[model samples]
Target: MLVKTFRGAFVCTALGLALGVLYGGWTALGVVAILAVLEISLSFDNAVVNAGVLKKMNAFWQRIFLTAGVLIAVFGMRLAFPVVIVAITARLNPYDAVHLALTDKDRYQQLVTDAHPAIAAFGGMFLLMIFLDFIFEERDVQWLRRIEQPLARLGKVDMLSVCIALVVLLVTSFTFATHAHQEGGVHADKGQTVLVAGIAGLITYMIVGGLSGFFEDRLDDEEEREQEAEEAAARTGRSRSAVVLAGRAAFFMFLYLEVLDASFSFDGVIGAFAITNDIVLMALGLGIGAVYVRSLTVYLVRQGTLDDYVYLEHGAHYAIGALAVILMVTIQYEINEVITGLVGVVLIGWSFWSSVRRNQALTAAEPDSEAAARVSVP
Candidate 1:
């Protein structure tokens, strides 16, 4: 299993280097490594979000995510998508975008900047949906029932969200739209297109985010049942059926992992534009991020880290929610990617540390009990 886990990542890294050598030589390798680390850093929140969702999927989907999903993420979205965007928006010939990225390193960065607005819109809305759903959706622990109850009730219809989106669009169109047009004048027409595209992306995010929630709820139900069966089996001293059921739950968790992986990769692909636009660099960098993310997910599952860090999961969901709002607003605001990433990393990192602190406190409290037990042990 360990060998299989690393196999695809190794192949991708090797292939990226081979192509880099043919295309741009050793400089390309340096670029790839730098971009990979950047992407990985920018996407730490993605790992946290993936862990929360992955606990609910089956194993088959997880394998597909590590294999095919990585390709789509690293290649289609990270590389080709930007080139395509540049071709359409920059009025550059599609071949020119490709050629520029390969031969003229200086110009490739220009095309990437030109490509950012549209992709940024997509990513912003995508993340917004993630945040909204996680916040509003019902969860097993009603710890924050005071806040969650109202949101969950409202989210049931999603009418409020729709209304809020409409208000945003209307306000943006009337206010920002006029301002943007006044500044750009003749190019004002394009502003409308950009606005429409942003809305479309937001709608798409809502659909995907809702689907993720639906699937997650179902998986949670399955987990509860499996847990009940395991408890019953333990009481009866029946091992075989309980073990089989545990295997089934594990498979579900793997599937959940894959879907979550795909969701987290959305922003990584979008953020890859900050580096070299050479398809090779984008693929290499994003692929490296994928490798570490997959490893992190597996580690979390094997160690049951999420179970230990209850608030860490909560922090990730909060980050996702905040990111979504930022993404939506940035459609017109031109927020920097580094800022977006850092915000999420800080939030999730704080949560993880808090979880660790909590666990430590629990452990410390337990030592006294252990000492008492020793004192009483006959």
Candidate 2:
């Protein structure tokens, strides 16, 4: 099962390494390997979150995710997106941006770094909304009951997540973002830039997430109607099932997933400069890591890992929340990518351990409960 799931990842890793060696010998190979590990560490929680969404998608859409979605992730987000950012921020044309990336790698990296505030704000808010919406929504399996219960109760208030997110944006825009600009001697209104970018992130999330939910709800309604019809036919000696996701619903869900991936990749793209300024190497390395992440998502869905370890999703979201906080902090201060990666690993590890303990307790109680039932019968 593992081999079947991860076959593509292994192939991609070999190709990426070979390209690395051809590009710059052993040193580039090492950098490529480090960048690949960096992406995996930064995005392990992304696989968990993605599994939750991908499981809902149909098989055809899943294939699209692995195929076209991978192209978009690798070239669009990892490569083209940075070029676009540099183009816009540095006021260069797309060709010039690409030229700059190819020839003047250091200048390209600095331009990308200069764009970090807006990028961080946008990605940070988008991820924060994801974390907020997850925590605020009520779920049957509560990982941290004491905290989640209260938040879920408050979630009954409409748009509570949006409200809280707006407040956070406002506070940070005026405080951290503003302070950073003043301290750095940047002449522009950094606070305004952060505010606009944050709002854009918030609105992007609302529109994409909202439309996806709307289409998904429509699909659910269709499924319910079809199930009723199937039941009626069953009474008349027939059985039928319908595809739940199709047409508009599947498209929107695909869009949602792509947007989510872009948001998750923002930090990793910026952090990659810390390792190396070679755009080709970064794309190769991070692309390989993304393949593995997608494979892991498939593995989780096929194996029912999320169903078995209920708290794993919760842990992933908490890690996302931590990352959101880290991104926001990074607007004013530098954060080591190692710290970001470790934070996610620790949270996910803790959740996995907790899930194991819960499963063991449940298993141990089963025989005792059966014995007690037998005693009562006697």
Candidate 3:
């Protein structure tokens, strides 16, 4: 099972390393390996969150995610995104931006760093919305009962998540973003930029997520109608299978996943400069890491890992909430990537341990319950 799941990841890793060596010999190879590890460590929770969404999609769409989606992630986000950011932030043409990225990597890196405030604000708020919506909605399984129970109850209030998110955006924009701008002495209207970017993030989440849910409901209704039609056909001795394509529902979900991935990649993209500024190397390394993440997501879904470990989703969301907070703080402060990665690992590890304990307790109780039932029967 492991081999079957990770086969593509292994292949990608080999090709990435080979490309790294061809690009700049042994030094580049080492950088590529480190970057790949860094991406995986930082994005483990992203895989979990993705699994939760991907499992709901059909096989054909899943293939699309693994294929076309990989191209977008590797090239579009890892390569083209930073170039576009540099182009916009530095007020350069697309050709010059590409040239700068290739010829003057230091300047390229600096411009991307200058653009960090808006990037952090946008990605932070989008991730915050994801975390907020998850925590607010009531679920049958609660990971942190003491906290989740109260939040779930409060979730009954209309638009509570949105309200809280807006408040956070406002406070951070006025305080951290303003302070960062003054400190950096670059953009005088940094606070305003942050505000607008954050709002754009919020609206993007609403439109993409809202459309996905809307179409999902439509798909469900259609499936129910199809099921009824099939039953009627069976009763009339003309039974036929009903095939419901994922259609628009899957498309929106795919779009949502890509946006979610881009948000998750923002930090990694910036942080990769700490290792090297070669955009090609960054794409190769991060691309390899992304393949492994996609593989892990597929593994989780196929193995029913989320179903078996009920609180895994809870932990992933909690980690996402922590990341969202970290991103917001990073608007003004420089946080260690090590710290960011550790937070996610620790949260997910803790949740997995809790799940195992719960399973053990249930297993232990089953025998006693069976014995009691036997005695009562007598």
Question: Local distance difference test, per candidate?
Answer: 0.63, 0.90, 0.90
TM-score per candidate, chains pooled:
0.72, 0.96, 0.96
Clashes of each: 9, 0, 0
Candidate 1 per-residue lDDT, tens place, 281-319, comes to 777767776776665665565567789887777777777
Off by over 4 Å in 3: 180-187, 240-245
Assess the local accuracy of residue 67 in candidate 1 as a C-alpha lDDT between 0 and 100. 65
Error of 3 at 221 (Å): 2.2
Clashing pairs in 2: none
Cα displacement (Å) at residue 55, model 1: 1.9
Tens-digit per-residue lDDT, 7-121, candidate 2: 9889999999999999999999999899889999999999999999999987888888888998999999988998999888877899999999999999888888888889999
lDDT of 3: 0.90
lDDT of candidate 3 over 1-378, digit per residue (tens): 889889989999999999899999999999999999999999999999999999989888888888899899998998899899988887789999999999999988888888888999999999999999999898999999999999999999999999999999999998998753432335467889899999999999999999998988888888888889988998998967655546788999999999999999988898898888889999998889988888898889889999999888999999999999999999889999999999999999999999999899999999999999999995
Off by more than 4 A, model 2: 179-186, 236-245
Q: Enumerate residue pairs that collide in model 1.
A: 54-256, 54-257, 57-252, 57-255, 57-256, 58-251, 58-255, 128-324, 131-321
Candidates 1 and 2: which is better by TM-score?
A: 2
Better of 1 and 3 by TM-score: 3
